[model samples]
Target: MDIPYTSKPRPDTGLYNAKVGIWLFLASEVMLFGALFSSYILLRVGALEENWPHGLLNIPIGTFNTAVLIISSVTVVMAWASLKMKQFGRFKIFQAITVLCALAFLGIKSFEYKDKFTHYEVWKTDGTRMTGHIEGNPMFLTKAKLVAAGKDKIEFLADPHHYSEGKLKIGAQSGEHKHVEIAIGDIKRLSAFVPAHSTYFAIYFTLTALHALHVLGGAIVIGFLFGPGSKMWHTDPDRFTNRVEVAGLFWHFVDLVWIFLFPVLYLL
Candidate 1:
């Protein structure tokens, strides 16, 4: 006679747990980024005594990148829909498009970084070393000239009278005596300085770099699903579809982070 055997029930991932887990993870990420951004706000605001670095950021390039990420998010949804409908061919097409969009986002980001480097706007934490004088942009000279020619707003905002005292102090200390000539057009070129080896620059670099890493990770996952080693999952469309859904969740998270970051870094 043989004894009957019973198998134990597997643990269930309840609907609440699935949703809560994602939210909890996002909350933690928010806290992490919140700390970084708060530090940035404190340091920059304190240093400038009220001014912030919004003018230094390239709004147009950032806006274009924002659009790219938004479009990529849409393509990701399309890819998921294709998988759900069991249209593997169309799913692949959408997946590829999403990857391309991610690549384009990185390309645009590269250009922005290049612009920063070229302008010598990059900073270090140390006080002794810094690149890029605030006067490099000719637009500021033009604005100064305009202000001198009786531009009321310019005279009000960056009045040579006010800046002269501060400029002389800086010049005397640094032994860099430069005359205060308020060129009418130079006001446009005026940008807040990034201190050498400053924590603000570190935070900026780290946050953006981490976001880019997420995009790279998403691209790798997508590639693996369609690459040679995908045979195991390919044979089982249901399982493969679930995998795509999970990947889509991660991609959406990356996009969501950028949504918040765009306003904090570029807009604010």
Candidate 2:
């Protein structure tokens, strides 16, 4: 059966069926992210001041990703505009750039995640805590893992200041990383900057991972429209244009979420 309002706007809403559906979906997404954001605030506000992590995230990298998303947002709009002008070639070119930007954003995010996984924080039995890198650049290193490997000592490069100690000063380079040989017997706890590492990381992963999923999803849909789905442009130009418009809306929302996320997670 033919679907009503697939190409035409509904009189009551002045929006095609797909457009209306996308807006409704975005509304639900807002509530889902809003709840998570609220939880982050509560967790940070309630946590001990000295224990909350800060300056662990790389601000320069985050800012660069932010620019990538912003550029993708502009390209998505241009893609839609190209379709409106019946410039199929331009639409394809713009959409291709948008997809590439999405991929670049994902690639950078994976690098950041890897950095966190390799980085470590250790609590010694003597009540001293230190954070930095292990000599071997291991992923998810823990006390149990060290024991299971029969390793009695690890060569560590400790950062001058723990992440919780202070914010990263502007234009300041990292201080010298002190080398320390830590004995397994003196280790009380060991963890990477993963979800289980602390409450701050838990929320950080939850928020950024969810947003990455959205970016992936949007990229897939837009990719389809830019590829095989473009056949619709020949058979039904209006419907195909509507499809691109719908995908663009979702892309914009994905970009907007990251805009809020960059500063919250990386800067503050």
Candidate 3:
């Protein structure tokens, strides 16, 4: 038997089966992200004042990714509207742009993650801490590695202000960095910005990685509709349009989560 309410609304809810189903699915998504966000706030509040790192993320890159997701949001809406107007060609163009934006966002995020893994923070026996890129751009390098290599000193390009400076600033990264040499004997500890570095980074990676997965999942579903799944549009146009609307709803939720994520993780 054919599925009821595939294209038609149910009397009680006045929404098609897929639309009702997507709304329920989105409700669960909200709860999942909500718990993680709450964990972030609790961790931040309980941490020592000077221990939390700030102004470490690349705000400029974060801002650019925000714009990319916003653009995809607009394009997805236009794609659904194009289907409503029976303009299949326009729908194809708009949906293609949405998928491209999703890819651009993911590419930039991967670049940011690579940068973090290569970056390092060092605490010297002299009671000082500094963060920046170690010379040669090694990933997850440690004091033991330097000693094992029999290296006497490490050349580092260091940020002038300590991460706790609360620079409360953006785009001021132009001229405030310098190069320095650190002796292995004086090194107390060394770590990259991975979750083990601190509670702040733990939440940072957990939240962003989860959000990235959602973006990938939404892109895959929408991309399918843009390709082989478009065949449904020819055989059953109304059902296909309803499918696009449901996908669009989920895409909007993905975009909204990033909006909240940008400021919380990057700014304050």
Candidate 4:
């Protein structure tokens, strides 16, 4: 007796199997980040003041970084399009540009982090003295020249009304607005929102470090897909293109997370 041949076709699943798998994986990732963000909001609300450790961050720098990540997202899309068009050379160029953008982002972030450290803005376990000059408010001078002249005899008293107005107004009648020396020791009240060197700093360092790790991981994936080791996959052009698309999806996700984080952590 002759045995009959048997064959069974796999389900279409509409898109390629790998692409479908990646989407499902990304959905799970969304749930993960959503949970973290929710936790961040809860913790932030329970804090003493909405300002928390710092009133606000440097908005311009944060905005620049935001633009960088947004541009990277666009470049990744262009890379995917290039791959689809079978323009391998163009695909490589776009992929390389995206990676450079990622590095540039990290460079700017480094400068921001360094600024915080150098200014003693970082959190400390044991109370540490912050050494930087506090940007003085200009409106506080009563006799401006006297203060500017550094006359020790001139008395500088905090005007309660002016203080309430959040401006430093000088007594025009007084010979000159006297400049008063403010010492950290003179701070009669500390914002309950300000963490005493430890808690707030820890949160900031931890959050930013984790985000940086994600960027690093994305970089590694892109490196593998476009680097020398890619030769074997390149032999099979279709597989190589699929790999690029998968990496693009991951890179885009990383960029999206940063967009949300930049506003919540820095701007707010």
Each candidate's TM vs. the true structure?
Answer: 0.63, 0.97, 0.94, 0.66
| Candidate achieving higher TM-score, 1 or 2 | 2
User: Which pairs of residues collide in candidate 3?
Assistant: none
Q: How many pairs of residues collide in model 2?
A: 0
Q: Rate the local accuracy (lDDT) of all candidates.
A: 0.60, 0.92, 0.92, 0.60
Q: Candidate 2 local accuracy as lDDT?
A: 0.92
Candidate 4 per-residue lDDT, tens place, 1-268, comes to 8222111112554455566667899899898778777777777778765234442346688889889889888888888788778787887788788888888888888877765543322112344222232233222122234345664332123322221121122112223332344433333222111223335555666666677887888877787676774684456666666677777888888888888888787755
The model with the greatest TM-score is 2
Backbone clash total, candidate 4: 10
- TM-score winner between 3 and 4, please give it: 3
| Predicted candidate 1 versus true structure: per-residue lDDT over 1-268, tens digit per residue | 8221111112573333334455677778778877876776776667663223334456778889999889988988888788778787887788888888888988888776655543322122332222243344322233335356775332222222222134343323444433333333333333232232245546666788789888888888876766653464556665566566666777888898889888777755
The alpha-carbon RMSD values of the candidates against the true structure, listed in the order shown, are: 12.0, 1.2, 1.6, 10.9
- Higher-scoring candidate on lDDT, 1 or 3: 3
Residue 102 C-alpha lDDT in model 4: 83
For model 2, how does the per-residue alpha-carbon lDDT over 60-79 read when each residue is reduced to its tens digit? 89999999999999999999
Candidate 3 residue lDDT tens string, 1-268: 9889989999998999999899999999999999999998888888887799888899889999999999999999999999999999999999999999999999999999999999889999999998889988999788888899999999999877777766453236655778998889989998989887888888999999999999999999999999999999999999999999999999999999999999999988
- Candidate 3 regions with alpha-carbon error over 4 angstroms: 148-150, 169-171, 174-176
- Least accurate 10 contiguous residues by lDDT in model 1: 155-164
TM match of model 4 to true structure: 0.66
Q: Give the TM-score of candidate 3.
A: 0.94
